[model samples]
Target: MREHPRDPRAAVIEERIASRPQGSWFTDPDPLKAEGDVRAVIDAARAQGAMPVLVTYAVHHRDCSGHSTGDLTAYHDWIEGFARGI
Candidate 1:
């Protein structure tokens, strides 16, 4: 948000957040579940005058089980098909 955008990370993060599929749940991990941890991340990011981003991930036990969205094809297919056209 700084003038002229010295922080390129801001634009990238914002665009990613905006382009994400609707109703998608992209929150910080459990360690960052605490208010203090989240605040620390945001505060550190803000010090650089950049936007903050919340990224999500899954353990994907199904990968080993060959059930969950295990591979790139499966991931891309699901993302395109189910992901609200994001």
Candidate 2:
């Protein structure tokens, strides 16, 4: 998994997970910082010879009546940023 700035366990979890010889899954949970985050994760994965899988979770009305709702414009920009990162 990618290291998220807001996740308290990000560093520890990433260190443990990154040691495995497997792909890394990155999620764009924060629109404001997702671009840089994605880029960093991709770079790190590539350095380790692992494929990076990006999981975009921000979308308009995501999760239906549950949490994770986002604005359409924001999602659009987020997606653009995500592509740029790749």
Worst lDDT 10-window in candidate 1: 23-32
Local accuracy by lDDT, each model: 0.47, 0.71
Model 1, range 2-63, lDDT digits (tens) per residue?
56677868888779886764422333223323334445656766797966663334323335
The top-ranked prediction according to TM-score is 2
Q: Name model 2 segments beyond 4 Å from true.
A: 1-32
Each candidate structure's count of clashing pairs? 0, 0
Model 2, residue 22: distance off in Å is 7.7
| Positional deviation of residue 29's Cα in model 2 after best superposition, in angstroms | 5.9
lDDT of 2 by residue, 1-86 (tens): 34468788888887997677653344555555777877888998789797877776555576766676767787788778777777
TM-score of every model versus the real structure: 0.28, 0.60
Badly placed stretches (over 4 Å) of model 1 are 1-33, 56-86
